[model samples]
Target chain A: MLAGSQNRVQCTEIVLFGVNVAMSWAAVQGWFHKLASPPHFYVTAGRWVPWLGASTVVLLAVGLGWSLFIAPLDQYQGASTRIMYLHVPAAWMSIFVYLVMAGSAAVGLVWRMRLAEVIAASSAPLGAWFTFLALATGSLWGKPMWGTWWVWDARLTSELLLLFLYLGFMALQAAIPDRRAGARASALLALVGVVNIPIIHFSVVWWNTLHQPSSILRLGKPTIHPSILWPLLVMAIAFKLYYMTVVLLRARCALLERERSSAWVQQIVTEQIALCHPLR
Target chain B: MIVDPQTSPRLGRALRTVLVRDLTLALRRRGELANPLVFFVVVVTMFPLGLGPEVDLLARIAPGILWVAALLAALLSLEAMFHPDYQDGSLEQLLLTPHPLAVLVIAKVFAHWLTTGLPLLVLAPLLGVLLQLPESATGVLVISLALGTPTLSFIGAIAVALTVGLRRGGVLLSLLTLPLYVPVLIFGAGAVDSAAGGLSVVAHLSFLATLLILAISLAPWAIAAALRISLE
Candidate 1:
């Protein structure tokens, strides 16, 4: 009888997942449809920037206020438990953004879409920053919890590898002269690197080693108390919004840089920079 | 429309002729064959010096050390896979042919496997004896090389294609491809270690063969794609 209700809950989650997928698909489609033309993207981005900025501020404000004050502290960890609000979310976003970046890269490769390339290039630096944040915050969390600031734990090691993969992609792109070719090659590299992500995840499970065993705080099911869980959930949502705001901004810059030769770009740049006028 | 059963069609004939010509060119420079072999020997010898002179300890680590050396040597030769042809613009001539570049890449991969990979397998028994690998372990050493070396060739082909045009691309190729090589390293080293422990070699060999098949099926496509991008 309990199994029946549990199955019902799972079915509900799957339905929710489906709805989430459709919503995300529609939202992204609407976003790109407007941004498909370089001039349109530039003008549209100008108008949307304030809204993205405002949404980010509001979400982060609400999320942080609840997490820092309203959410109860963990009995075991005390105030140090607050670190999860920053650490867990940063770590999740770091990995999540790379997958999205790589997916955009794959689309760029398959369709040779200029917008996709802009998105891929834009995603890298931001993803790298988040990855660094994850590692930094993770180290901070580790010092208080695991008794050391750093360990060659499997999860930590894999996170480090992910960072290297990002660096490799960036370096490979910088080395090649032809932008289009570089984009394609880097996209292939990204695709290949993402394949290894799963292997990195399972490396701990597959091997008996010093890495900490899987925790309830990880994906799928939560093993932590409701007190600990609520703050983490809020922080995760905040991080997702933070990533979106930054990625869209960077994508606008990348589109401008790549499409600077277009007439629309010339008009947009002239209009935007006309007030200052040329130094000449 | 004439069909020949034994002899290849015109395109096939061109590919085979090119293959034979390259093989002959390689055979004429027998000293070139010794480069990887000597490099392999030197690399294997360096491990003992670096790790200190403990024979039993050396024996224990021998399989891993030996595979690493072989992997490095294979990588060293990959630079040469397209270097000479690329420099001479002979690769362009071949590309211009009616035959597919993929076939040419396959032929080159085979030639590399023959010249470098085959020699490594042949020399494994000697290395095994020197490292005190035991008679039972010889089969594991041989089989791992047999299965693992093709993977090395296929993967190396992709790296070679990627770096074929750049000057002094050897180190970059090694760094880029080495991480991709970890799975083969794990299984190859595991196979020999398992054999040394009196465990089932069959299971390890099966895994090795699976890796080899996967490499064979997919690596040519990757190599071709990389070549097109680099040469574009």
Candidate 2:
């Protein structure tokens, strides 16, 4: 009886793991499609903006406070190591959002889903911004540690290419006259280029290189002390919230533009104006 | 739209009709083809000027420089493939032909390869000599171009089809196709450089040939699909 119960618990755990992974990736599309229809999203944004804004503010305060003040200095990198609180999460988010952006694009293209395309388009600018942050912070960290502002290392070069991919996606969409066609074509390009990113990530490990291998993420236990790890964890959550706040704003804009001709859009616009001028 | 291939006479007539029509049109706008060729020569020459008076350094970088020039030259001409025809409604007329549009598109790609690719291949050896490349590398150079340039034409055709109707698509076309060209760039340059260093070049040439065959069989259909979207 105990064995069977344990087996059931194991199965449930696996199912929950799958759900979390899927939701992390698919939540943007699901939110936009199911609950965040033009009027619902608009009205909800009006109601929830305060909560989102407040939580984000609180999270940033706590996360940044914990990371910079409480985390112990690294043994190897010493003071220069503190840059991890900024660099690692930005880098992780850059790759994560790109995968989401490309996956959404593929879904949009194959299914002709306008909502998927809107989310995909909305992800591009955010992905580009994160990529810039990763590059800038990386350069800052590299200068003090590696003694140079730049190196043509594999990861660095590939990150630059990701920026180019984002720029190309934006340029193609803006340049194309037919918006739907532009979305489809750029989606195809994104799908094709997705393979390069993994190659970039593994290139250092695959070949003998000067660049250091994985530090925070690896198969074994993390090498860092707890004092360092806690702040890193806190900062990661803060960065994620920052991303959510920005995506919410962008998605709300996209929802309005995509559903402009719908009645809900008109009503939401009217309500927005009335809120802005309550005395009227 | 279906060709009864058992009727050899009709198949031959359809093929010839496409080739003749494309060639005649290309011949009239001879300047379109010349632009890419001139760009190729200019880019190749600019390298020697930029790198300065060291023969060894020029020879060392020759393979990469030549391949880069060829890649850019191919891209420069790609926009012309469907742009003028797309603009002037000739593509619509071609679409109306009883023969398959895929076959018609393939015919145009062939004409493009002949006018643009063949000239670059012929001119490559002269540029190779200017860079002080060894004679053995010259053979690898020509053969790689022979195999690699056709793949460029095939791949570029798809980008051209995708951007045929868009204004200011030339730069965007480069961005889309440049990454796809990296494997070809690596192998083509590897072949010439290996030969220049007196290493075996056969393996690289064979790989280039395999890629070209794969691209030739696949790209026409993809380009045709892209063309349909642009037109629609």
Candidate 3:
């Protein structure tokens, strides 16, 4: 009888495990479907925007302060090295945002998801801004150290090309009158342009070696001191948060514009009107 | 849904029809076909005049100038790739055909290369002489243009397909394509530079060939996808 009970218990345990796996899978699917729905996404993003914005502001302030003041000076670059706190994070985010845009674009194209398109359109300008910041700051840093306003370095040139790509994406999106078509068209351009980033980097590196030989060596290549590295990491996270905040804001605006005729948008507008008039 | 096999052509026949039709249209519009070639010569000519007639200086910069001009000229012709078809509703008809759209796009791009890129390849050596590019490098210059220009047409076709439905797409098309053109420009010009320096041109030529292979294989599907998006 005890042996029989043990076998029954083992069977029940296996059954429970299978049921748990199936339950979690359904839950994940349910969550994905809810997020894909525009109204659900709008609500979820609206709720998170304030927290993301707050964290971005707080983290950026702390990171910048620490980087500029508290971080140890570079043995070679000295105070000029502080520019890296801004440049590196901005550069990282610029590339990261493009990948995100491209990923979202691919998702939108494959699944025909409306929210994915909104995310892509919203991310382009922010990506452009970060890329511009990277170039401008890199130029500023170069002038003092390299003794020139610019050098045709691989990273710098690729960053410049990235800026042009962003402009092209925006131009393509704006030129197409239909919103959905424009989204898909720009998405295709974004995907195609992603291939150039690596080529630009490598070609510029090859060109630099061919032309300049050893004039400009890579700066800050040795292991970074923790004092400096920590703030840089903080700044990178802050920039990511900043991107999230701005993308959410822009996407919310885009969602409203695209879905103005939808029932949920109408309800939101009516609620806003009622809140403002109160007595009417 | 039952139908006679006689009415509909097979995939190969459909692809051939697209190629033949595009070639015939291009031939009929002789002026349009000549525009890019003319633009190439004019642009290449501007550099020597602008920088003064220093033979060595011109020769030093000739490969770059010629390649850049050819790239821009190719771009100028790209707007016409799908604009006429898109306007007259044949692009839609082409999409509706049973043959896959990518095959049709490949045929169209191939015809574009033959019309725009082939002429540029033939005319490059003349520009080489005008720029005083080194005699040894002239062969590599033509070779590079021959290999690289088709890739440009293929890459440029994606941009043109995306913008074909828009009214003011010409300027936007250039903006969209020029960044993507950088690699081809780098490698093509590098091949000539290598040859001029008495180095083996194998590496640069191989790079260009790789780009051509990649562009040919991947760009048609992108162009077809973009065309459908634009049409929708």
Candidate 4:
């Protein structure tokens, strides 16, 4: 039961969200148990793929058009600020995906959940690409506005290092021959990297201040106008949906490849359109 | 011989045996011990040849160059840290021992550092002089490295354990360890960089200590976990 709220519609959502928070322990455990079965996860994620892809496209279209053409130009930086629509979100997602990847990897390691392992391993390349996009778009914005291609600011260096971390995770995954071992080992590495990320980021921030006594490159205004903020938020959500869609697709392919010998896989291969429904 | 780990039930005794065993074995193979030292000297020397011996330039970059060279030298030795043990089946025996693997891993990492990192610490001052590092900063270079190199070995142990089972893990080992080494590199060199400028060096050195403490407390479990993954 939830506490009192104003509107009836919001009351329902609030109650629902409250219950979600309250029972999350039992619910999450049962949810993970259900999803741990590869066949179930494959079918469920397959059902959601099309809807996720469609939402991503629609959001991207609106977010992209609005940010590029309709958002207000900054008084100081002018239109160059538009790139933040992609840069900030991609950068944010880069770290977001790392956490998700590492969290799933940790769960996978602890529980030996095959689906979680697939999700964790499949998330690496997406994280890397997002990191790359963040760097590329950041540099593009930097060249025109900041008068340099790069700044050794805290965020920039951390992003570059994050890229390397992703690459290293992928490299470790590829090096080991045994599938299960490789996944678990790289999962361990991912968890290790996650713990180090904050240390690296803040140390870079501290190091930057120590060396560059007078900081020239200032980050965006702390109180951004709503006109810019709204579009940025939209773009961020769209990028998230994009990640969800691609990760599911990748997970499914990886699932099939890894589980080719299982009866469910054989049944699916024998019968086209094998995905009859989502998780019941 | 399994030697019955239960016979040496004391944690201290087990740790000492592992430490002494690694150190004595490393001592017997004295020639292999020189490889990282030689590699360190050669890497530092190559910089002057490549950069044309500009005193101010080399002096400016000395801290970075020396710190990076030390890191690479440590990594060069890391490939062999556990591979030989794994090959000889002793790693399997080590895993099977009743003693805590994390504690034993700490012992092994410490021994590796004493053999590899300490020598580099001793050699760094010579390279500093060659690189024209300011005399006052040399001590800071040594101290920063003293704090940083063990952390590298500790961190590198995890990567080595993960990759030790592979036939071609050399490239993968470096890839996996190098990014994680960046924070230590920044602070280790930053400490020297500050010292050369006659600035207060406490912050950087303190950061190095922080990193060392962090690695010591956390890395053993990771190395132990990776070892289990590789062996299984």
- Who wins the DockQ comparison? 3
Q: On TM-score, who's better, 2 or 4?
A: 4
Q: What RMSD does each model have against the real structure?
A: 8.1, 6.7, 1.9, 5.9
> What lDDT would each prediction earn against the true structure?
0.77, 0.78, 0.91, 0.91
- lDDT (Cα, 0-100) at B196 in candidate 2: 92
lDDT tens digits, residue span A64-156, model 2: 777777776765666677677888888888888899889988888887777667778888999999899989988888887767888656566
DockQ of each: 0.30, 0.30, 0.82, 0.81
lDDT of 1 by residue, A1-280 (tens): 9999999999999999999999999999987777676667767777877787787788788778877888877666666667778877887877888899899899988878877777788888888888888898888877877678886666676677677778867766766777888788778777867765674455433321412454323322347667667767867876787777787788888887887898887887787687677653
Q: What is the lDDT of residue B73 in candidate 3?
A: 97
Q: Give the least accurate 10-residue stretch of model 3 chain B, judged by summed lDDT.
A: B1-10
Writing each residue's lDDT as its tens digit, candidate 3 over B1-232 gives: 4435889888888888999999999999999999999999999989988999999999889989999999999999998899999889999999988778998899999998999999887899988999888899989999999999999999999999998888888999899999999989999999998888899999889989998999988998999999999888
Across residues A1-280, which tens digit of lDDT does each residue of candidate 4 receive?
3434447768788999988887997888888788789898989999999999999999999999999999988777888888989999999999999999999999889988888889999999999999999999999989987789998767889899999999999998987778889899999999999899999898888878877766465445778788988999999999999999999999999999999999999999867644554342
- In CAPRI terms, where does candidate 4 land? high
Q: Please write out the lDDT profile of model 3 over residues A1-280, one tens digit for every residue.
A: 9999999999999999999999999999999889989999999999999999999999999999999999888778889999999999999999999999999988898899999999999999999999999999999999989999998887888899999999999999999888889999999899998876787678778776776776674556677678878999999999999999999999998899999999999999999999999999
Location of the lowest summed lDDT over 10 successive residues in candidate 4 chain A: A271-280
Error of 2 at A136 (Å): 1.9
Worst 10 residues of 3 chain A by lDDT: A214-223
The local distance difference test score of model 3 is: 0.91
A best-first ranking of the candidates according to their TM-score comes to: 3, 4, 1, 2
TM-score for candidate 2, please give it: 0.79
Candidate 1's C-alpha runs over 4 A off are A1-34, A61-87, A136-152, A195-222, A277-280, B1-15, B130-135, B201-203
Q: Once model 2 is optimally superposed onto the true structure by TM-score, how far is the C-alpha of residue A119 displaced, in angstroms?
A: 1.0
Q: Which residue pairs come into collision in candidate 2?
A: none
Candidate 2 deviation (Cα RMSD): 6.7
Q: Give per-candidate clash totals.
A: 0, 0, 0, 0
Query: What's the lDDT for residue B171 in model 2?
Result: 82
